[model samples]
Target: MRNHYLVIFILGLLLSGCVTVQLPGGKVTSAKDVEYKQPAGAFKEIASADADKSWISANTGNTISYFSECGGKSEPTLKDLENDAFAALNESKTLSSEEVNYNERAARQSRASGKLDGVPVELALIVFQKNGCNYTLTYGGLAKSFSAEAAAFEEFKNNFKAP
Candidate 1:
């Protein structure tokens, strides 16, 4: 009947709407897999040697890591960096929470622990920022299985050069 044909057509249209085309390899692409290119000449290196000196002085006696990337220029002070790092660690639901303290000198101390490879390890990360520069010195344990992270941080700091 005409009604039956209309019903069949409507059903076919609805089913076609839900159909998804699979790629030749049966792989589904996700939006997150898309690559984004960094804008050219985006990051400039800090020019002052004194900035590096300040970072080194503030981060003594701690294993720290340094990473610099070409990005925005909203330079944060040592206090701001310390506070931000602490806030990030505090907000992590995976780690066991603990009290953290920071001094006026922009020194930080905290203890936290979490699972690593089915084993438990304690972690301590300290941060120091100096002279309101773009650099932040961070010392932390990735896991209790390894030793101090300060040496790695020192190596990273030593590699800083004005671009």
Candidate 2:
């Protein structure tokens, strides 16, 4: 009887070790595959100082919008834009100004360590304002799986225009 009990205990341990934790929706998929479809009329281009040079693109998926003001008297320099972007992130409780990269002009990069929807999440905000234009990029997702989203964020930034 003792041997039988020991065998059962060993089997329980082995089964426990093999157990895998699964989310409620079965196997989890990539956030990129989740399709962050922008709403109809979600983004509109408004004219800036230059013809189609300054504009703002609204990203509803991430609950944020990007504005680029190039070739205008109000056009913000890289430093000013970075400060504004960091401030915005802080407003959303996504990141703190000190946690993000503030000095880098070419790519002001910063990460906010936190969680969203019970998943480990990191928010990365990148701002690049130059030549009378400012670009604000933001992405949030699993901390370990941010590369793809980060690239998408950069692409969105690159598509900035003056309205």
For lDDT, the strongest prediction is: 2
Q: State TM-scores per candidate.
A: 0.30, 0.35
Model 1 residue runs over 4 Å out of place are 1-75, 91-133, 137-139, 146-149
lDDT of 2 by residue, 21-131 (tens): 344544421112111223223334333221212122233222223333333345444455545443322223435443233223454655555433334444555556444
Where in model 2 is the C-alpha error above 4 Å? 1-65, 74-77, 90-105, 113-122, 141-148, 154-163
Candidate 1 clashes between residue pairs 3 or more apart in a chain or in different chains: 63-149, 63-150, 64-150, 64-153, 65-153
Question: Tens-digit lDDT track for model 1 on 38-57?
Answer: 11121222223212211211
What TM-score does structure 1 among the candidates reach? 0.30
